[model samples]
Target: MPGRDETDILHSWHRNADAWTRAVREELIESRRLITDQAIVDAVLDNRPRSVLDVGCGEGWLVRALAAHGIQAIGVDAVPALIEHAREGGGSFQVAAYDDLIAGRFSQRVEAVVCNFSLLGEASVERLLAALPSLLEADGRLIVQTVHPLIACGEHAYVDGWRMEAWTGFGAAFPAPAPWYFRTLASWIGLFATSGWQLCELREPLHPQTGRPASVIFVARR
Candidate 1:
């Protein structure tokens, strides 16, 4: 069972699904417009995988993008509403939580598994890494895009811990704020190594105009 913090994080997404979908699709956020979305897509395409699994895929944007390139992509998310939206967007998607994926609920191992700004906590990272061996084919790759830990740390001291999303600029549409655990860059490297994943490439997606890193992309091999 998820602890209080995990529960809150899940609930926040469930409640704010619609708003998030709109924000992402409409490009209301600067990060998506400048770096996040395209960066993730580029990383996936560079791998040239025949099939990809999009874990925690929200509204299936990445899946749709991948399909445009003629790549087979499957999306899975915990929120039923988001899954429904993803289907409406014309992509294959299923309602599955992180735990469900870890349990091999959705069969068919893929050449690549991509988590786009979806990994939220240390426990989740550990659990997902534990399940990768079974879900990935031989020589499979894992790609992850997340808020740059340095940017996420912001004014706070550099450390690993839980940080509540301010939800600033999102307006009153968001009813609840989402909380994500902050992992330092070093912590991330160590975590992946201990989980039996070899760090292959670490790239920062820079804003087109400002040249500031908006997200960190990690490519690992099993």
Candidate 2:
């Protein structure tokens, strides 16, 4: 029984899956093309994990990329359309929602769990973080890449709340972007601690032209 906001996220993704898939496959997003993509890959490789779980994997690009490095990667998303596209050309992907993961629907554990620009809901993300510790092995890591709070906090008070995404620079082919929960750096640290994880490393990949961080990466261990 998630709220309207959560449901709206799914609806928007379902509506935009094709366009999103094209964008990722075609490398249309400049931030991702120039910065964030390689940042997450390097972060995951630094751990040298044999296996990885990509939660909220859209179109399964990360899963495919991980597989290229000979690492086993499983991707899961709530959107079936996205999962379907992933299955067609990406690595192992399944249709899984946060509820499914929280409910122990998948017993397989991995050395690392990576969430790249996927966590968006407030209640859903909070509950999911609380449940994620169970999906890892001893000393497993969680690597999360997100829009830098400092940059995303534009014109708004720095606090925990939901924000609308216009997908402004993501090209005109995209549908309306969904609302995402915004968390400041301190709040992000608090969330990790609340979930019984210890923050170990932080990376801020910068956009070359702007010299501004494209995304902030958090590496934590359970």
Candidate 3:
């Protein structure tokens, strides 16, 4: 199977845009519906940010959610279709790539920058992280939620590498997934340090029924 790469991943998102929009809106994925979604929301809320920049905000779900808490949120994504869908749902959204995220001038620094299961590409994620300090307030936080390394590793080797994602349980509309890179726990911490971030906290939300972690949340500071 081919591994996760930039070209293939973006192409997959473009191809799967419609299906993904429906899936997110309808809560089709069991993990997101049961655990990861609320997990990320709660993590962001914990910081009590007045303004948040949601990186890779697909369909603007998180942006709308944060608005209910009176937090101003701006969502940006590389996919035009996803950004369009997000805007239709009512919130601030922009079409931007990883490079755009690093270079685009915002009106002001935000209190929190959240990446919810979206930092999958290796180089892009690293570069984006390095540039985030400049976009945040003095006490700002960078919140990242990703697949639990142990769980996501499945039967694969326990190292940093790209893997083919299977869009299981998302139904026939999604036969495959975009590129996803797996990072070990140590690797995650190292990435943060090298990207000019200090690891503040790590959270793993569990599946209530099985007690298995649904995803790992990393809260960091510059």
Candidate 4:
């Protein structure tokens, strides 16, 4: 089976823009605001990072939130339509693939890189992680959140497909035909450590309603 391309996912998202946006706002963004925003907000609170780069900023929801907190934020997306939708919300949005990000996009290194539920679909985690240092300031931070590797690989009857679950004895199998890389908590920290990042914090949010773990959140300083 072929790995899913980020572009293909973007195309699909664009095709269902209305429904996608609503789902994002309801299930992912608005509903999980406390879990998502609070974790990121706390990590950046002490540093007061100014300039921000939002990788895979779909629809600019998080970008706008960052701007509201007084951070100068610019969001980049692979989909032009999503970027356009994001731009309409009062922040700068650029149409660029994660693999294509270079120094030219920003005048200087940004103080923080916020990648919320993005980047997992990328074909190369090493290449994706490697790009962080160049995009980050010396004391900058990288805040990332995604479906927990363990849960992401497992079969979830609720979703009508496999979710994060155990496979190969230890690691996780990719949930779909996409390049969904799932790592255990240790593996996750290890990957960041190899790239010269010091782990700052790890938060696993409990669902507001069920109190079950929902997502894995990490804060790393470079």
Per-residue lDDT of 10-108 in model 1, one digit per residue for the tens? Answer: 888999899888877787888887678899999999999999999999999999999999999999999998998889889899999988988888789
Off by over 4 Å in 1: 1-4, 170-172
Which window of ten consecutive residues has the lowest lDDT sum in model 1? 1-10
Best by TM-score: 2
lDDT of 1: 0.88
**Where is model 4 poorest over a 10-residue stretch in terms of lDDT?**
158-167
Model 2 lDDT per residue over 128-204, tens place: 98899899989799999999999999999998887888777776487767778889999998998998889999999
Off by over 4 Å in 2: 1-4
Residue 24 displacement in candidate 3 (angstroms): 0.9
Error of 4 at 63 (Å): 1.2
* Tens digits of per-residue lDDT for model 4, 1-222: 244454555555456455445545555444355475565555555568898888888788887877788989888877777787777767888887766774345445799988887755434555677767888888898988777665654553322221231223312222222224456667778888987788898888766775766678788887
Q: Model 3 misses residue 120 by how many Å? A: 0.8
lDDT of 1 at 201: 100
Q: Which has the higher TM-score value, candidate number 2 or candidate number 4?
A: 2
In candidate 4, which residue pairs get closer than 3 Å at backbone N, Cα or C atoms, i.e. clash?
151-164, 152-163, 152-164, 153-163, 153-164, 153-165, 154-163, 154-164, 154-165
lDDT of 3 by residue, 11-80 (tens): 8888888889999998888888888999999999999999999988989999999999999999999999
All-Cα superposition RMSD per candidate? 2.0, 1.9, 1.6, 6.6
> How does each model score on lDDT?
0.88, 0.91, 0.89, 0.67
Pull out the clashing pairs in model 3. Answer: none
Candidate that would win on lDDT: 2
Candidates 3 and 4, the one with greater lDDT: 3
lDDT of 1 at 219: 99
